[model samples]
Target: MDWVRQNLGHLTRGQIFSIPTMTMIEEYVRRDNQFIAGPDQKYVCSSDDLAEFNIPQGISISTYDRSNVIKLYEHTVFRHALSYQSDSPRPDRLASVAEHKGKIVGIAGASEDSELMWQVGVDVLPEYQGLGIGKAIVGTLTKRIINEGIVPYYSTEVSNLQSRQLAISLGYKPAWIQLYAR
Candidate 1:
């Protein structure tokens, strides 16, 4: 144990030790982007396709935020998506949003990879709940992911039946339940 004891001081000083955590997330993001940006082989929702549906007035889709939208997004999607993290120094990639009269109603983000994993955050602002906005946004987002030739996947906690049902409605099946290594 002398060797361990001697190295403890050096190790505690934040000496560079090679590990996969940093590269893991980085590679994961890369794979996702490559997947999403791939050929539009699958069929995601298109602008023309959405036009057929009656998109309510005062609602707009974009990727902008005026307030602490980043924090809000991390909090919202993390409930279901185990991989949805709030780690510092986030990757600068996310999805568009659906706004209503200068307020956010729904949000979504897609990480680029061979198969893009997407999270569609539908926030009804307490007053706009159950107005089919969430469904429309998720549907639009999922269709886009599929069209990119990458399989679309969503994550939700087992207790979140409502979110899971929403994923099912969007034709997403249960991929797997992740067990973390504590």
Candidate 2:
């Protein structure tokens, strides 16, 4: 806490989480023998800026039932889209799954992070990436969340350019940054 006070005390909430500031914080924590988890960027789309997005051609997107979603939790490739932990306070609440030739190829899942916010995550099978699967599913789910009167947010590691691009393409803008120490 003292390190944060010394290094970030002067900055506004938004500025404190900038890349340069996080880099310095990471260095300081390393010297203190603690490890930084992420300098993750959080993105959000407002109801006004979030326009309707068309589902990609040949890809069918639909909501998954809770039981089916639980089965998907066992698949590691879908880790980003679904949380398997039974004890988690933010369990997966809704999912927009993409199907290609009757096989599930991508997913956009959401967790109710707070009363007014839902956090979305996406996963696309390796063979299906770059086909607009990620963007379509995430965009579909974001609109659904917004219609429900909740704001949807997405977060990705700073280095994950592809993931960040997917969010931006779906009308999300960087809203904040966060780093955790473990």
Candidate 3:
């Protein structure tokens, strides 16, 4: 089967380059560059922009409160789940954590040394599936992570259409393809 090369090394900032897909790449360039530049245009990609939910663990719902170190430790389950989707653990994971407003609802983090990058993770508190919260969280995380100078990357089992769709919805194209061998 034809497969794309997966390079953990980043091309720009923390951005990981997956094998480029012509269609998706074109879309990315167009959308990212099409933003209107007005004096009133607010930069909408910070971790602090989200205010719809109560702060979990004393931190804002989507904001990174590094002071609350304990909250950062709570994302291990999600970290493992996200890692499992890929063929291997992300070698440069710098931070990992889950966010909960009563229960775990989001997960995100960075890789190695780059701040501008794509961190991979997921959310959905069992009862929250199908509500678009997963998609929102991923969007929130993606924008926040990418804004930090890291290119976020993630993978899911080829069978997971929900996740695959979600990733595509957020502008993440497959960087590489993986086939498990016994």
- Top candidate, metric lDDT: 2
The sequence of per-residue lDDT tens digits that candidate 1 reaches over residues 2-96 is 63366333453223122433243344456546321211112223333333233466777754322333554544533321224445233213454
- TM-score: which is higher, 2 or 3? 2
Question: Sorted by lDDT, highest first, which candidate order results?
Answer: 2, 1, 3
Q: In terms of lDDT, which candidate is stronger, 1 or 3?
A: 1
Checking candidate 2 for backbone clashes, the offending pairs are none
Ten consecutive residues with minimal summed lDDT in candidate 1?
35-44
Q: Which candidate leads in TM-score?
A: 2
The weakest ten consecutive residues by lDDT in model 2 span 65-74
Q: Estimate candidate 2's RMSD in Å.
A: 3.0
RMSD of 3: 13.6
Q: lDDT of all the models against the reference?
A: 0.47, 0.84, 0.46
- TM-score of every model? 0.50, 0.82, 0.48
Per-residue lDDT of candidate 2, residues 44-143 (tens digit): 9987777557777899999864456666675667889988775579977778999999988998998878988989999999999998889889988888
